[model samples]
Target: MITIDLITGFLGSGKTTFLRKYVKYLLAQGENICILENDYGAVNVDMMLISDLLGDHCDMEMVSGGCDSDCHRRRFKSKLIEMGMIGYTHVLVEPSGVFDVDEFYDSLSEEPLNRWYKAGAHITIVDAGLRLPLSDTSRYVFASEAANAGVIVFSKTQLNNPEAPSNILKYLNESLASISCRRKLKASETVAKDWNDLTDEDFKRIESAGFKTYGFEKQQVMDEHKYESLYFMEKKFSLDQIKEKASAAINDPECGGIIRIKGFFKDAEKGWMEVNVTKDDFTVAPVENGQDIVIVIGEKLGKEKLAEIFGEPAEVHAD
Candidate 1:
């Protein structure tokens, strides 16, 4: 059976960055792989970031969001069944930040997929400097995403305080306990090394790390009402102007917990550029191709104020 790995984490937790590195390592080992970007938005902006990785060794696919859970699950299984016919060494699934793990296992347990695919690593990326004092709903997402990880890796550690990792771990356990989950992770099950310094052995360890299962009180917080993604399209703002406006949104509590601002816009001078903003990182870079759109991801996002800030969004979608 071809191995299927789930690379999951909460919003702005660095799943895309880690997936890029892991995919590169897999390709270096001459493995044929496909990335299934299972996002919960109408647009899959993250997939555009990894377009350069597309080629013979690495194939990219996506399951577009903006549908009900049951419909999305059916589409997910259909995509898997279609991909199963293709000969891939491994399939890596990067789900939306607010996904339920049960969908993955439940889908794989069914006919055709069960025999064709074997569950592989359940890697969850944790931001080293994950801000404390997240809402209970956000806290539930944080803990549940990590509940069954084979290995939980911390990103951007070198940029954070030395105590950030341990502090975040403590918060994670607190979240688990609050949700009535008995699963508690240990230091050995996690790796906090900087991604730039990861060695071949480290990659091997991640690939070999197997997932575990434990029961937890499940919440129905994975719906779109819990997390809102506001989309702004065809806005002719330079990267600098966008950043300035985004900074305001981040600092404004009235914007309603805006955590991520990402997507592409055409710069008058530089052509198209990609922007990914979070509390920790504000990155803008040139890209060869992209659609003219910007998306803000968070909870209870104030649509009116966001429209005033980023220009009227094309639409608001939740997955």
Candidate 2:
């Protein structure tokens, strides 16, 4: 059976960042790999990033829009069938932050899917920064993702002290205990690491241990909160300007409780920069890409205010 790894996390949790290096490692092993990019939004921004980073070495198929819809699930199943027929040794599934973790596993138990592919690892990335904010009822989607994950990994660890992950791990375990989950994950199954600092050995350790995952039943619950994505077309802004605007936008109540802000932009003075912002922290790093677009993900965002903050030619869409 082909390995089917579910890479899940809440908004701005670093799923794409982890996959960039993980896919490279899989390719080095000479394994045939295929990626099924499942995004909740109509736009495939993550797919753009994966393509820019991995290029032609990987096979990719995208299932865009809300996964809760029957149409989306059919598309997803078709993609899985296609991958199986192609005989890929491994498949990496990157589901949107708002995805239903149980529904993902349930899809596999159905006909045609179960015969071809066996469930592999179900890893969820956690943004240590937003650990507290995710507790709100509006953020139940995030909680569900955590409750079902086999190996919970932390992203943006550099922003915190060495003990932060351990501390957060304890907090997460306690949180999971509070909820009546269908499956239980051991402490050893949860890990914390900075994607930038990972070495080949680190990847190997994760893959070796993470592949053994616990399965859960689907709940079929839909997020009551709205998730919207705004695309900033113009990218020529100073690093300071971009940071300042992001800070202002996230803090403003009129902005409708912004949860995640990410995208590639060109700093007029400092070259290209990648901006990733969660409620806990904001990060701006220089990147090699010349593409100048920034995608912001959040709930009930103010279109006019976002357009003004992100600059002109902003296109807003449902995720």
Candidate 3:
């Protein structure tokens, strides 16, 4: 039997970046890994990123049209069985940005795939800079995914504003409460907080907050609809240019209802900086060597509009 981990998140939520990092972690632990990338569009960006990281140490399978419909589901299950037959140890499945883990799990649990692989856990990558309240449908779904996950990891935490950490905790608690699973879910406070203490705080805060901790969570009041979502994906850009554009966009007087923005950029001096924006707050940090990919999730902003604001793309290749 192979352990299968589901990695899910909304569009431009750092899912590919998280997968790359996780692959490195698994490699460090000497784990044999296989990756399945569900590509909704013709371009499989996540698979490209993962391939660059895994090199030849891992196997990858692409399931097209898996974002919706059962065709990809059946193909995915068949591939998993094939991998199991070949003696693969662990499998990681990254669904499309628009797909929900609950739906995927429900679909998988009923299939022949259940015999070859068990859903080990779910890891959702959230853009901390989005600063989304637990009430938003996207955030609610993310939180629900976390509530059911054996281990929940909030990525891009370093790029979040000061208020992000607390808001995330609030959302986590609220999601857990709605699911009726556990009112409190432990989270690391200092990145060094003991796991036991973290769990204790999860319950205490939920009880005091006057909210349910776990069960099926409801969607919150979302000011912007899915079509109105702010989304931007750029291959490469000058770090300074990205910062200036982001600052201007977030501070624009006409920018109403804009919520989340995230992506990566490169500075001549700083190498790579991952950008995350929530509400009016934004953060940019210099990362070591990383790919030159950036995505911005915002409300009411379209790709063409964002491209215009960010200027013409640069031709620099990501090392």
The numbered model that scores best in lDDT is: 1
- lDDT over C-alpha atoms for residue 261 of model 2: 78
In the range 1-319, model 2's lDDT, one tens digit per residue, is 8888889887777898888888989899887788889876766667766775454457888887643556677788887887788878888999877786656777899988898887877778876655563534334565567775657888878787887777666656555554544455555776776677778887777676544333333334344446767887766666677788888888888877688777777766777677777667777776666466767777778888877777754576666
Of candidates 3 and 1, the better by lDDT: 1
Ranking by lDDT: 1, 2, 3
**Residue 191 in model 3: lDDT:** 26
Candidates' C-alpha lDDT: 0.88, 0.72, 0.56
Per-residue lDDT of candidate 1, residues 1-319 (tens digit):
8899999888988898899999999999889999999987888888888899999889988997645888889999999999999999899999998898999999999999999999999999999988788988899899988998999999989989888898888888888888898988888899998999998899999999989998799988855478888888877777778889899888888898887888888878888788888876898888877988888999889888877888888888764
Question: In candidate 1, which residue pairs get closer than 3 Å at backbone N, Cα or C atoms, i.e. clash?
Answer: none
lDDT of 3 by residue, 127-146 (tens): 55454453344555555655
In model 2, the number of clashes is 0
Please rank every candidate by TM-score, starting with the best: 1, 2, 3
* lDDT accuracy of residue 273 in candidate 1: 86
Tell me the deviation in Å of residue 300 in model 2: 2.6
**Model 2 lDDT-worst window of ten:** 212-221
